[model samples]
Target: MKNKIEISDLQVHYRDTSALNKVSFDVHENEILGIIGPAQSGKTTLLKVINRTLEFVPEASMDGTVKLDGVDISTMGDIYGLRRRIGMVLPLPVGLPLSIYDNVAFAPRAAGLRSKSQLDELVERCLQQAALWDEVKDRLSTLGTKLSGGQQQRLTIARALSHQPEVLCLDEFSIAIDPVTTMRIEEVLKTLQKEMTILLVTNLVQQAKRLATRTAFFLNGDLIEIDSTDVIFSDTPAQQATYDYINGTFG
Candidate 1:
């Protein structure tokens, strides 16, 4: 498989604290890379760093490299274009005041797509991909915030996909959802793996097992284990922290 994203000696610092310490890994094209860790373990920060959102944080600095498609992100002249190629789904569902259809169309418009039919095509494609069109089919004009929590999340996912990103960053996308809704989101994700590389930060252990092609375990802002999901779960040796956490010794 082609390398969709790569981290080489990656590190992030906030004042005296190291948020990510020399993290290194590669996400294959169209594969799922699950990031598992306890709260404040830098899981989210790592994603932000990769997506270049960390630059907005006060006193945040990073070292080494994050590459997408063999191109170092720091060297990319088009940060906006780079971001469009890497979509991010936040932990909380962020809905615009606009209607559901408009929310999904936002990115397309920002990307300079103006033809009504073109935007309509993207809207349908993204909503269907998010498993939301069927639910919102009759009410595309309704406010996205009016949907149930799960549906709102799916709407957010649809909004992220509007850019046709090569890589999708999922920041605990299912954390606020119920079990059944989480399952539906998982189904949508499974379908997504056919075209997009997913980098997921999740607290749910079972989620990684169910959807990840590979997994990375982080503790104290350091990447301790990264391997094929089968090996990481069943065969490869894990760090003591990962072992203890996975075995329920500690969170």
Candidate 2:
């Protein structure tokens, strides 16, 4: 598989604190790359950098190379375009204070898709992709925040898909969802892998094993090892820390 995104000797710092140190990895096209680590492991920071959200942080700086489709994102002329190509679903469900239909249609509308028929089709398709259409299809005019926690999380995913992004970055999407809904979303992700690359950052080791084609382990802001999911969870790994972390010894 071709590399959709790549990082080399990447380092990020917020003021005097280091968030990531000399990290390097590749996110292959049409594959789910799982990132597993404990809190403050730089998992979220990595996603923010890929989508260019890290630029918004005060005192945050980076030194390294990050490429998207063989092009250096740092030299890209359009910040909006870079972000539009990468959709992000954060841990919390932050639904827009708008109608469910409008929430799903927001991205396309912002992108200048004004045709009602086109917006309708886009909304339905994205919602269905997030496994949320049937439940909210009839209540398109209802407020998005009125939905349950699980529904709201799925709605966030649907909204992210509204732009039809080339890459989807999910940061602990299952945290707010029930196990049944998490399983459902996992299935949805498998289907989505056929259409776009997925970057999944989750603390759930088992979830990574169940979904990711390849897994990368991070600790103390360093990429310890990246390999097939099976190998990362096996009796031996490239790093003893990785083996220890996966075996429930310590995060």
Candidate 3:
């Protein structure tokens, strides 16, 4: 299997403190790799680095390399093009203040799609992919900001997918949602996995086990182990730290 993305000796430093330390991993095509750890354990930082947003923060200095689809994004000319290909959904749902229809169409329009019919088709297609079209189609003119928290989050995912990105990075996707809504989002992600690579950050072990093809453990900003979900969950390690964490001795 071809590795869709690879990170080597990855480190992120904020001035004097290191937020990520010597992280390395491969995200295979069409698979979900859960970056799991407690809060402030670098899981979100890892996602930011993978999605290339860490560069946006001026205080962050990254060391080592990250390659996506055999190309180093650092050497790319069009950062927007790269970003469009590898989309990200942050912890918070972000949408324009415009109508829900316009929110989904924003990316395609900015990329130069002008035909109203084409944009309309794109919006529906994406919202359907996000599992939100059925609920919002009748209210296209409504403001996206007016959506409920879970609805807004699904809309954000739709917006990311509208660009036909090859990879989707999500940070804390189900954190603020009710159980039913979280399940709905998970179902959408399950279906989309065939069309996109997924890198997720989740503190919920059950969610990680249910959604990810593989799981990577992050502790004190370090990657301890990465393997298939079953292996990670079923294998007994001699090191008590890993076993203890898995068995609920500690996070």
Candidate 4:
């Protein structure tokens, strides 16, 4: 498969604390690359760096190159365009104050999609993909934040799919949702991988094993190892730390 994203000797820092230490990896096109690690291991930091949203953190600084389709994202003139190309879903479900329909339609509308018919079709499609269409179809006019936590999380996913991004970055997406809802979204992600590359930052090792084409393990700002999911979860891995962590010996 072709490389969709390339990170070379990437390093990130927050004030005096190092977040990512000379990390490097390639995300393959239409594959779900799972990032597994314990807390403060830099998984979320890595995602923010990829999408260039790390700039929003006042004390954050970065080094090295992050390229999307062979072009360095830092050199890209249109930040908004870059962001639209990579959709992000955070751990907590953050719903816009707008109605369910408007929340899903927000990004497309901002991109100048003015036709109501087109927006309607796009909204329904995204919602269906998120496994939330049937639940909220009759209540599209209701505020998005009014939905239950699980429903709101699905809404977040639907909104992320609104612009048809080339890369979808989900950081602990199931953290705030129930198992059934998480499983539903996981199924949605499996279908979505046919269309876009996915960066799944999950603490759940089994979740990665179930979905990721390949898995990378990070520890205290270091990339311990990366390998096919089976190998990473097997009796042996390139790094003992990876095997240990996967087996729950230590995180």
Candidate 5:
């Protein structure tokens, strides 16, 4: 498989504390890459770095290179264009103060899409992709924040999909949702991976096993191991720490 993203000697620091240290990895195109780790393990930080959002932090400093499609992201002139290519969904659903239809249409509109018919089609398609269309089809005008937690999460996913990103980065997306709803979104992700490369930062190990083509284990600013999901979840991984973490023996 060809690499969609490449990270080389990447390091992220917040003042005197390190978030990630000399991390190196490649994300294959059109594959779901699961990132599993405990709290403060820098899984979220890695996603931010990939999308160049880490630069938003006043105290954060980064070293090394992150390339998208072999082009270094740091040298990219269009920050907005770059972000649009990498959609992000955070742990909590941050619904905009807009209607469901408007929420999904926002990004496309900002990118200069104006035709009502085109916006309508894009909104419906994105919602369908998120597995939320059937649930909210009749309620497009309702405020997105008025939806249930799981529904709002799905709406956020729909909004992220509006731009048709090449890469989708989800940071603990299922954390606030119920199991059934999480399963529904997981199915959506399975379908989406065929179109876009996915970087999934998840605390749930089983979720990774179910969705990720390959999995990476992170611990205390270190990348412990990365391999096929089968190998990572099996009795033998390249690293004992990976096995321990996967088996619930340790984090």
Candidate 6:
């Protein structure tokens, strides 16, 4: 399979603390690459670096390289252009104060898409992709923040999809939503994988086993192991530590 994103000797430092240590991995195109680890294992840090959002962190610095589609992201002239190719959904749902329609429309408009018909089609398509259209189609003008937590979470996914990113990064996206909604979104992700590569970071090992083509285990900022989901969840993993973590013996 072709690689959509590649990381080599990647390191992230925040002040005196190291957040990611020499992490290296490849995200295959059109595949869902799951990242699983305990808290503070640098999973989120990895996503931020991939999307270049880590630059906003105070005292944060990085070494090594991250490449998207064979192009070094660090060498990109337009940060916004780079970000537009990667969509990110966070653990917590963050809805803009704008109406649901406007929230999903925000990205395209910012990209200079002005045709009302185009915006309408984009909004519906994204919302549908997010599994949110049926719930919000009648309330397009309503404030996005007014929706339920689960609805808002799905809304965030729709907003992320508005840019039609080549890569989608989801960091513990189901953490705050109810199980039913989480499952629904999981189904959406399975479908979306046909359209874009996905980077999924979740503490839930079972979720990774269910959705990921490949899984990577992280421990104390280190990438312990990365392999096919079958191998990662096998009776004996490539690393004893990975086996322990997956077996509920340790994180």
lDDT of each: 0.87, 0.93, 0.85, 0.94, 0.93, 0.93
lDDT digits (tens) for residues 122-218 of candidate 5: 9999998888899999989999999998889888989999999999999999978889878888998998989999999999999999999999999
TM-score of 5: 0.98
- Residues 65-182, model 2: lDDT tens digits: 9999999999999988888899999999998999999999888888888999999999999888888899888899999989998899999999999899999999999999999879
Model 3 has an lDDT value of 0.85
Q: Give the TM-score of candidate 1.
A: 0.95
Give each model a TM-score.
0.95, 0.98, 0.95, 0.99, 0.98, 0.98
Clashing pairs in 6: none
- Cα lDDT for residue 242, model 6? 96
lDDT of 6 by residue, 41-150 (tens): 99999999988999999899999999999999999999999999999999999999999999999999999999999999999999998888998888899999999988
Per-residue lDDT of 188 in model 3: 84
- lDDT tens per residue, model 3, 1-251: 88999988999898888888999889999999887776777888877876678888999999888999888878888888887887778788886799999999888887888998889889999999777899999999999999998889888888988888899888887766778978878988898899889998887888888999998888887888888888777757534565667778887
Query: Which candidate's TM-score is highest?
Result: 4
For candidate 3, the per-residue lDDT at 3 reads 97
Error of 2 at 91 (Å): 0.4
**Candidate 3 segments exceeding 4 Å error:** 235-239
lDDT for model 5: 0.93
Q: What digit string (tens of lDDT, one per residue) describes model 1 on residues 61-146? A: 88999899998999988989989998899999888889998999998898899999989888998888877788888999999888
Once superposed on the true structure, which residue ranges of model 5 sit more than 4 Å away at CA? none
Off by over 4 Å in 2: none
